[model samples]
Target chain A: MVVAEFVSELRARFGIEFKDLSILDEAFTHSSYANEHRELGISDNERLEFLGDAVLELTVSDYLYRKFPNLPEGELTRMRAAIVQTKSFSSFSREAHFDKYIKLGNGEEAAGARQRNTLLEDLFEAFCGALYLDQGRAAVIKFCQQVIFPHIDAGEFRGISDFKTALQENLQQDGNADIHYEEVSITGPGNARQFNIDVYVDDKLLGSGSGKSKKRAEQAAAKAALVGLGVIS
Target chain B: MVVAEFVSELRARFGIEFKDLSILDEAFTHSSYANEHRELGISDNERLEFLGDAVLELTVSDYLYRKFPNLPEGELTRMRAAIVQTKSFSSFSREAHFDKYIKLGNGEEAAGARQRNTLLEDLFEAFCGALYLDQGRAAVIKFCQQVIFPHIDAGEFRGISDFKTALQENLQQDGNADIHYEEVSITGPGNARQFNIDVYVDDKLLGSGSGKSKKRAEQAAAKAALVGLGVIS
Candidate 1:
């Protein structure tokens, strides 16, 4: 797609548009296209993708860290990983109608590379890279808040389960009750330490589990308790 | 160490110090320490590590993306990985005297976790996370510039080899001449395509090599050509 139409479409769709269409155009320029059109000296989107991946990491991480304040580090990492996967980023690309604008080489175009999740993911990251380079992190974050954050907020990337929260809410449904996790046993060495934790609600044991860390064992205990309570199958 | 001493030492060593010593203290608090003092309800550094990892990723990526404009995505990724490794980050932590400030539980301290590479890396990240939270990205970047980027600039993370530039400089020692890479042969199907690329300098075939992608093949060709010219061993 040409720069003018892309800009107009962006304005119409999102009420935001960049003045330097060439940067966005650079984002749209796949490495395949650059390789084919080497004489034109057009910059490909790979470097942008690199920068954008970092931009995406920081933005999404900031969001997750704030939004899921109670979530442990392991769960937060898992959720962030899920959110940044090829599937998730490609979906974000489709939400932005990126396929309509990406300029691919004839071979790649014929190979349907535009529809591929990896390509789409890279395109989305490159788009972020372009936005970041043009306007900076705030602009990229604003763009993310528009197209990416909403989906994440809607639990589209709920691949990682937070069983602890569910269990706590289930037990605290009627009123505020104390819940605690205790390490019942620990085995193995420091590097491969295995911890077994028992979760109790109001001094009543609900479930027990073992894992490589106390946090992981607590999560497993919570999950088992949740299953026992018929909250999850 | 106490907060005041930490702050004073920071200023004395780096000529800069965070006003929020409490936040810095939080960054130093390992989960083991928090676990030991559960009643105190102090925060662990894991969350900060999460945030700081992303911060470090973005800042380092920004530096690398700008500094090595000619590097392809693969090389850039490898270099970034090298820069973000536990060893690299632990060394950065040591450079900032982080080992002296980290707070660990009695068990962990007795176990010598303070000197561990992974823990030191996490401490470095947590420090970045705290700086980002107390100030912002600019502050975090400034800290990185002070403590981390200098080592990277000095090529401390030179694990990833870059042969293309060396060969080009070697060929262009006297004057500028056309250097080109041409696709010579292809094998296998689309999913397993192997490409043979030949590097030519002033109509002379310098080297030929094969790989999964044209860029990889080109790099391989460059490496081979460099080795052939005794530029690299």
Candidate 2:
């Protein structure tokens, strides 16, 4: 009944009713809540998030592939990441006022966890999963294209910029110093490792960065070095 | 000039003109070719692939967000992964005969490189990169929605299930086993790492897999185990 009310509110907001109420509820429910308080028989949104992640990626991939016929996969993937990051999803949750509608455990509520990026992102993921299951791909695609793509497209005219490269060039011109990158450490195993890189000038550590790969870490480190040097905006 | 001709050929095939011919060339140029001969003064597709990966993700993310009005992020990411993974990309490239079109070093060319999954996937990514730079977002979105998503949706509706969970479920059912995942070790200093995981049936290793993450390695192990058990078709 509570779930139905929530769905009704969402439907009223969007002017569309869902065929499956369970999907809507699942989208709003967090795993932590379900884990801590299982007696309510309320399920977590992890599975939905899992499913939603895939659905979201496919939709984004397809849109980019067709929309920017000249764009390659790597650029397309990055653009997708920027739009689908935890922060982005959290913002979407806020825009939709989804956090206000989420069903949280007392602990989560007391902890003021409803506004958390992690939670909001999870909720968004859960929602996608539900959409995929309840309304199918076509419906899901329709919803995403109508609501989300515009925001991303609005930023499509961004100028080509590389913070790290600019930073390096500035440092080189300032003192004729050779920029050096050294790997400090790596976290995670195999393909998931987060590389830590330190940028040094004349044997002095200027900045550090962490990323899923050495090059990215180096770029991040360079980017930080640039910021430290006040070389980039 | 050569790049322009290549773009024309691609345009003929995909029915889209290159907004930036250089982007198309980058998509077609393999890293091996660059590594083998620097005299060409040509950069490889690796960087383009890197950029395309991001672009692809963002494009898909944006599409999913609006298309699935009530959908979340997790499912969207997963679907994107399914579409972008080497297997899927390779399949798409193969179907499109992208391998025959890619410009490879003689060494790679002689090694049956045209049939290589990595090459095909890279080319696909490069193509996306090119698309984003050339025709902008609208064209890419149209093509992707028409081609990729439809196929996945069609396959999905036809009961094309995921391999990861199926393997996990089968493993869990044997003697009520509790599967544990661990990221044993990571290699390299940064974003690059090879993950190793051991899937135990009962504290005894039933399967072992290696990939970029415990999840991927576990999935790979699960798939291998399934193959060994004749569970995956």
Candidate 3:
């Protein structure tokens, strides 16, 4: 799609007209595209991504602080983390159809980089950064309120596993045990491998879980163990 | 000092009157104090510290982004880290005389927690949180611009030690060399112990340094080694 059409579409979708469209354009431009089109003098969005990460963090933090006035610091941190994680941002990007606007090099596009969660997450953050620069903090906050806060209000972040930490803390009160997680098995093909992980508390298997990755499987297993121990519901 | 006197002193010092003095009061109240004075209905500063941390990060990130437009994300992150580290915040707190106003329990006060850098840093962040809540983001930014920006302008954050990482990066080009730091000697009393550390590259003593702690001494030694190798000046 042409730059003008893309910008028009963005304005329509977001319901906010950007003062500096070039900044917004740069936000969607991948490094690969910039590298490929050296004569266009297009800059990548990495810097904007860094700025936007902070902006998003602060916006979410402010919301969380006000929304949960009585919540403790550690729980607040966990909630913020859940909302800001790559998976959550990727989901947001997918929902917003950010992939349709992202500009990439031929090679990257052929490699399906547009569909990649990490890239999508970075693009979303960069878009936020551009929005912040083009508008202001209030605009950024409003954007987050529209796109991000609904998820928080729905308690979408509640299921995020900090079960490992919770389990460790609970066990610590009854004297420290060597609580560890181990990948027990791997199955399926190389590209679609499923990992089975077990949570061990003092050489006893408390629970087991499976996921596409070891970390996820471990977290699932931890959650299971926490549930079994009646530490969490 | 009385709460009203303290509030008046804060107003005099900051030149900004808070609409809600209780929020500011909570910022200065340590958990220890609140735990001991349960009848006073005082809240601790931990939640404020958490909120203030995000505010400070966003403020610094925004400043860095605008100030050094050409800087890469990695460099921006490093610069932000330099400015926002606990040590830097503690310095800011000390310069602002935050230690004088902070409330502590008898036990914590007796143990000299008032002079602790970590506590001071937390207090400074809590103060920022209070200011943010009492005023707004603009007030927090203004406070940071007045107090924190001066340090950035003065290049106080430039010498923050990342020598170990730099040394490792430099060594990585010539294949991996076993680089390690070993504490050679400890001297002085418990409260003021000095550590002597030597940085070794492939079991060869490249440089040595002394400091108040092992980590500091190691960093100093790593810096010396980097200078010796002409990797950094």
Q: Quick one: best lDDT, which candidate?
A: 1
Which residue pairs in candidate 3 have backbone atoms (N, alpha carbon, C) closer than 3 angstroms, thus clashing? none
lDDT of 1 by residue, B22-135 (tens): 788889998888766656768789989999999999999999888776677878888899889899899989988889888888889999999999999999999889889888
**Can you give the TM-score per candidate against the true fold?**
0.80, 0.46, 0.69
lDDT of 2 at A42: 64
lDDT agreement with native, every candidate: 0.84, 0.65, 0.81
Which residue runs of candidate 2 sit more than 4 Å off their true CA positions? Answer: A1-5, A70-74, A156-233, B1-117, B123-233
- i-RMSD values for every candidate model: 3.8, 12.4, 16.4
Each prediction's DockQ against the real complex:
0.48, 0.05, 0.25
**What is candidate 2's lDDT per residue for B122-194, written digit by digit as tens?**
7877777667667765676766775566775464521313445555567667667676555456555333446
Candidate 3: tens digits of C-alpha lDDT, residues A21-98: 788888999877865664575678888999999999889989989876655676688899988988999989988778
Between candidates 1 and 3, name the one with more favorable lDDT. Answer: 1
Residue-level lDDT for A160 in candidate 3: 41
